[model samples]
Target: MPMRGLTILVATGDAERLHTALGFAAATAATGARIRLHLHEGAVALLAAPLSAPNDPARHKAGLPKLGELWEEALGLGVAISLCQSGLALHDLDLEKLDPRLEAQGPVSVMTGLGDDRLVAF
Candidate 1:
């Protein structure tokens, strides 16, 4: 089988979606796949330091780990993390205040850099 590359484009700020998307990135990376996580739209809020995890017990019972933990795992696994600059401006967020681990770039730069990777948007 061909090695598959995964690119996750996150566009929502919903805690549940962020949790799920982080899960995907960590899981994919665990399988030795190349992974890239791009935060856009409202999802850019997650790039802030000290991210919040979902508080619902059901999410935990369903086997989803804390979003912050999953994010750390993903980054440790070498998943490239990026945030949209326009998204930050749209939401009135300062780029300097975002997590230093995330690279700030335009959407076109991210998309063009993906090459042949499979893209999954959340």
Candidate 2:
């Protein structure tokens, strides 16, 4: 039987791009699809703590929900989230910032683990 799986690349620095990528991955995994999400570049911020320096509530609230919310939703639906080691170092973040279910891998290693299926980049 053919395996149904997806590995999405989230390497953009744009907030919207990162959020959209996660949304797509979450949606796919919601339907019992096996999924892998790779976070790189500024996209690593998606797995970080909510902003504390302060910003416009309108911008933040509307642009995307807090990372915690997104993370929870993905975990609830059994999606696997991960980080790019290089990207994490560049952004000064660590595995503590990621959900326990998520992994920290090097470059495109996560995609390689997916074993030939759909691959989307945002």
Candidate 3:
């Protein structure tokens, strides 16, 4: 049977992992599946205003999309992205300064919101 939906939880600060997660989200969303991505722990930094990806240069040189570009594509494909509020506080990041596209939510809400969706962690 096909997946009902997809929920991706990103808890690492690694840029490459974040890139991969967003890529999956974009691809799944393209198939008209409901996609929700939750950024928790150190991964919240990926949505910070000055989005930085140390490895994006190499990916760009290889004719691949940058991290930020992938993120935008995921959002454009109707993926719902959320950033954990506690994670933002842990990083001392102001929610207002992060990407406005992100919905600030608690971990519990992110988890409980998943209804029969396949959960994937990165």
Comparing 1 and 3 on lDDT, the stronger one: 3
Could you give the candidate ranking by TM-score, starting with the highest? 3, 1, 2
Model 1 residue 72 lDDT score: 79
Expressed as tens digits, the lDDT of each residue in 1-122 for candidate 2 is: 54578888887666666667767878888777788878776777644656222323554668865544565787788877777888788878877755578778876576558676688888
Write one digit per residue (lDDT tens) for candidate 1, span 2-116.
6689999888887677778888888888888889988887888666546666574655688756677677788888888888888788777887765577788888998898888
- Tens-digit per-residue lDDT, 1-122, candidate 3: 66689999998888888889999999999988899999987898655555557888898899999988898888888899988888888888887866577788897898789989999999
TM-score against native, each model: 0.82, 0.75, 0.89
Candidate number of the best lDDT: 3
Q: After superposition, how far is residue 79 of candidate 2 from its true place, in Å?
A: 0.9
